[model samples]
Target chain A: MGITRRSFLRRAAVVLAGVAAAGAGWSYLKGLAQSANEAPDQAASLPSAPVQQRTPQPHHWAFVVDTTKCIGCGKCVAACKEENNVPEDPHFNRTWVERYVIDEQGEAYVDSPDAGVHGFESWPVNSKYQNIQVVKSFFVSKLCNQCENPPCVQVCPVGATYKTEDGVILVNRSRCIGCRYCIQACPYGARFLDPNLRVADKCTWCYHRISKGMDPACVEVCPVGARMFGDPADPDSAVAKALRENRISVLKPNLGTRPQVFYIGLDQEVR
Target chain B: MQHLTRPVLLLLTVFLLLGAARWAIPRMFNQISFAIQDRTVPVGTLLGAGGHANVPQDIEAWKARQVQYAGPASCTQCHQESVAQWKVGDHAGVSCETCHGVASDHTANETPLPTETSSALCTLCHSTTLGRPSSFSQVKVHQHAGEATCASCHNPHNPGVQGLPTDLIRPKPSAPLVQHVVVAEANCTMCHGQGRLRPYPQDHAGWQSPGCLLCHETGPTPTLVGASATLGAPFAGLVQAPSVPHVTDGVPSCTRCHDSGAVRPFPQDHIGWSAGVCLLCHQAGPAPAVGGTAVGSPAAGGGGDAPRGVSISTISADGLPPLPHTVVGYTQCQDCHGSDQFRPFPSDHQGWEITECLLCHKSK
Candidate 1:
């Protein structure tokens, strides 16, 4: 039978609408399946393992770096290596010191030799910068900011990296796909791929040490008291007092990372 | 089956394929291992309720990781002596485990801990780097000491100090009792003269065979043990200078430590005095009458006449005897006042080097 033009057009339109609805439903289900892959269902199975005992008042851990006080001795870096079992390679520093040498001409020269493990002795090794008359020079120690609005946590596709109730960002090694997404997302460049573990690794502020009522290795070894760590929950804590009293600044204020690490004497040139 | 045409059958096949692909696609490509295991593995059977491997969220699991360093507090119980030494040293601020790695395992298993004593280890902190504060003691590793191990010259326990005075000289194994009956023609000075295999002490310059017999008995080596122990009194009689009361564990700088507002600051006359001059008169170990006797008194002087320039009537503010002569032009302090020199320095100065003369005895 010969079909009428009007009837033929109506049938084609109905078929196309049905196909579009099916496509949308299929994509929605696929998204759910992918999310199921990310959030591991094992949370309910493990009963014997001790979880962090939630206290009445959750701790808000904070770190303060006093650039004025840092001598660039690198004792913190050395101690971090011993405490964290960080690889001996110069490239794998969880925390490092950067020297900012600003000359009278308004040029900034920055260098971190061996991640400042051996200290800043013989710094400004570049012979070209040697003769430059410098107006200001100081050491700025850098570590994971453990940001409140951590881009790392937001970017982890597999829900592997998470922020704890106590405010430290930790990575679940089991679930990480080693995609390097979170590493790139970090604005402060704190994240790195752990060569040995094949996972995204960054500083946890020595989680093992901090949880047990001990200071982080870097904070413990700093002779000049350049690094400070404490719970802002406690009013009398040094970190809280410093944050309240000192003119504090963070690594990247414009990025809105809301970093828990505050710095005293932060220069405008520092990124 | 008869009613089914090519168009109708093809449409049914396409719908079935689309349904299958939607179900299988996630399982095939993505990490749906946990989702698959969630159904098969019963809660707490093989893969726990989470149906995944361990995650660091488990605080206990995270804590289970091996801890190497036990911290400084762990060593204090057994290593009291080293702790005490370190407390007084320039390295007092440094943690013991910084240099000594992974001590927790050692504490648990009694396994031997590695002690890094190489110069390279010292250079880790002490190498003259550009950024280190000038207040910290640092040096150019290559230029400071040519291939010399830091511990060779400086005591690692207290790096600021040098090796003890006793390390330089072995005590005189009291003269071999002559061993045989001496004849009238026997010449003791001839055999025991300077540069001889058994050289006599420089203090016995003019002593002849008879004078030696006064202190040494002519016999077949009398079996009197503990004779050297009793020699402390006689030795004090020979040298009237006061002895250092405290233990001198490689004490290189007496004034650097004692010159400050210490319990017993050095006297005014001793301001520019060097170590050689101090050692020339003062003995090691302890003074004979340190607690009770006054300076330069008969008892303090070991019941002997005070040496020239040292008088019983002259006492400085600290009650020590005043220097008899100006310390100027006495740069070669060991020449006239070294251990067993012409005038003979106290026995403690026996092994001291000429360079150590200025450490304590700076001339005004």
Candidate 2:
């Protein structure tokens, strides 16, 4: 009875399946145990510290772009370029100001010449606005929103791009494989491949400066105070006050990246 | 016993062979491997054990990227006087490296830094353009200077009028101030001569000062005073900037509290405003009723000066307490907590920095 070929085959199959199921279950249990171990260790240590020994609160760095205050001076772009060594080419910018001209008919015309390094003095050369009666015109400065849920971070093939504890998303140049998946994944069109470094580059909110407790160069040079960056944990920071006081909105909010860069007086046509 | 031993050995071999086949077969097939990886599994990545080594090395490499700007702090070491002068000057907010170019090399290698004295440099921010905030002091460069360099009349350091008549410093609403005093009154051509370097304008070639009042009477086209109301008080030493209006104790840094993200942040109009000039204008203690915006009035009422309304629960949302000791000077956690070292990590904690340590270790 035991020597039947079909029965022997069935028994062998059962043994193999049992071993495979055990292996899968063991790995799953290990993962659950690891995650569980992490929770209590964190929880137990926090409340034990005395009140006076508390470290500076972990910062939540935020950026505010006051479109109403932004005169589209392009000074920010100029400052950012000088600070970051961004390519001199107009097509590439870590930050740029686009002038949106909305007409009476509800059509919007947008252009950012030379990434506003030269400012928005020059309008569209062909001039679609000339034929149509323009209702209003405003400048919208665009930069990396440093989204809390960063698509660029998700798309990075290597673990090159990461969001810092302070909320700034950074790209590790050494680890970046020069794949433009991040550039394509960004809804805000914030990322650009660095032609010289041959790696993807975007605004870091000047990590070097911010880490050293200084404002980003763009915020440093903006004469009209259009761009502001600070940790929101401190109630007195400009970003906090602006966040609390201003009716702020993010670009392409429908996609829901939860951008840290809040814009005051953002136009409907702005994307 | 021998028959049973053979069957057990045979079962063990069969199980081992099946396990190896299951692991290797999917890895050999690209589509199966891709599905298992949930990504396009590169053969180089799969084969190379160096992938794990890349993580820390790449992180350190990214940290090693040279920060080109040495910042104003570096310049303060040698050029304290210039920094002091520039700090109080109208261009107080503009960092020294902004106009002088990146100073990292200058500080490191004593490289001769560039000094841009051209009007073009001045006009980058100061030139009248459509998008420039009307509050900012901008001028039509051609009309404003008229062939003369800005440094000719305005001091580059402080930028207010220099080397001019004393009364012209505080010009009346209707005073015709001469750019230069008349050297030879009767023979006006001696100073205002056609051969002179800064000759009279083509329109004012023949006309003189008394007759200058006929058209050019309104006082030098009036310095752009559109923002005069909000530009803070007139330059009367350090007290002229703005008053702090709140207790300045405990605050280790002005920007820490006054920055855009701070609770008592400065006005939006003060963009690019630097900390060097904070104490210059804003005297500590309560702000005067007349001068300066009442900055901390709302928070000032809270009695305790601790930054009010902070949601401390959200401070470190990851539930990892800060380290007991500051990691300021300590660069590596492994230096002290390595396998053989003092208070060795719980056999599990990996290498990390202050950025990582603060995720779990609550620091004082």
Off by over 4 Å in 1: A1-58, A122-129, A235-247, B1-60, B140-149, B152-157, B160-364
lDDT by residue (A68-132, candidate 1, tens digit) is 77877787888788878788888988899998888998999888889988776554554556688
Model 2 DockQ (Cα-based): 0.07
List runs of model 2 lying over 4 Å from the truth: A1-57, A71-75, A101-108, A120-138, B1-59, B160-364
lDDT of 2 by residue, B1-364 (tens): 4544566688789979976865776568642231222222233333442344444434333333445555566777788778777777787766676567666667766779878888766776677654445566778887766899876666565674443445646554665555443333234452245543444333333333233222221222223223321222222232212333333222334443244222243433333433333232222232211222221222223334332112121222223333332222333444444423324233454554555544334344
TM-score of each: 0.50, 0.50
Model 2 lDDT on a 0 to 1 scale: 0.60
Q: For residues A1-271, what per-residue lDDT tens digits would candidate 2 score against the true structure?
A: 3455555667768987787667656654664586566556434322221211112567788899998877665778887888788888877899999878777889888877788787654435324455767677777888999998999998777666888777888886645556688999999999987756657899988875665566787887675678898877778788899999989899888888999899999889889
Error of 2 at B120 (Å): 1.3
Interface RMSD of 2: 13.0
What does the lDDT read for residue B188 in candidate 1?
Answer: 56
